[model samples]
Target: MNTLPQWAELLVSFFIILGASFTFIGSLGLLRLPDFMARLHAPTKATTLGVGGIIIGSMLYFSLSDTLSLHELLIAIFLFLTAPISAHLLAKAGLHLELKLTDNTRDLRKKPEQYSDKDS
Candidate 1:
């Protein structure tokens, strides 16, 4: 006894396709970008948006079918919270390791004597 509009189904499908495209673009950027920081931006930005879009599509589809808000919200929330932290940690670690690139725009390591140690 379900009566759903065709437009709603179409919209949901559109969102799913959009999300998949974003994710694919992100993966391509990760592979094709030249440098570490540049490459870091690809997945962090695009993939996050892509996953968010997919989660939203899931929420809409489930809500329409089940008439319950459900736990898709939690997945979106967790992804938003964690993805940025993971990206930040990755960038920081890369800087700590002093990984260099041909087109590096910023210096990674601190200059010597910038740190003060009385024992020294």
Candidate 2:
């Protein structure tokens, strides 16, 4: 059982707390915000960042005491790589369905062809 030094422990704690805060805020946004588009922004952006921070903190904690962890690095990498792709897919589905957007939700382009993948 290795004990982390004060500085390393502090850094790890900071990252964990920051991650938790962002995750909580993102969850709140998802629940409270009206409409799918607004809801999509919350989890994709904030939750990804939150989880990344937590992963980084885990990496730091383990790396400080042991060899650098492949698990944490891989998780962070996969998360960052997938989040945007998932968000894009969800948005495309929403557009395909022509889901209603709240008035506060900024209007998408007037023309769908510009962004849509449909063939002429």
Candidate 3:
């Protein structure tokens, strides 16, 4: 906005661009990676960082221009907390389903049937 100082504008713009780029790269990785396990790596790390960058930018912009902005921080915290957990769960599910992995992958876990016994 015209009301924002030049430095704040530049900082926000830089972070926003960085965030969008990371998000785009993550999406690209998902499409380009050759295997399911490899593909799972992309959105978990890249998208998390991407969203964090955008959230940081928004938090900075709003904090500087108006009252102390906290919602963005909360969103960032939630993303940080949940992304890895969700990724782990998804990966576990994939493993349980016996999804194809890259040629070089070495699975160390017991068979999915072990999980069934635990669940029972």
User: How many pairs collide in each candidate, listed in order?
Assistant: 0, 0, 0
The better candidate by lDDT, 1 or 3, is 3
Per-residue lDDT over 33-89 for candidate 2, one digit per residue giving the tens place of the 0 to 100 score: 999989999999999989988998998988899987769888888889999999999
Tens-digit per-residue lDDT, 20-117, candidate 1: 88999999999998888789988989998888788878888878877877598888888889988999999999888887765555553455555545
Against the unseen true structure, what C-alpha lDDT does each candidate score? Answer: 0.83, 0.91, 0.88
Which prediction has more favorable TM-score, 1 or 3? 3
Candidate 3 accuracy as TM-score: 0.84
Q: lDDT tens digits, residues 1-120, model 3?
A: 337889999999999999999999999999999888888889998988899899989998998888789999889988999999999999888978988776676565646575565755
Q: Number of clashes in model 1?
A: 0
The candidate 1 region of ten consecutive residues with least summed lDDT is 107-116
Model 2, residue 8: distance off in Å is 0.9
Worst 10 residues of 3 by lDDT: 106-115
Quick one: best lDDT, which candidate?
2
Candidate 1 pairs with clashing backbones = none
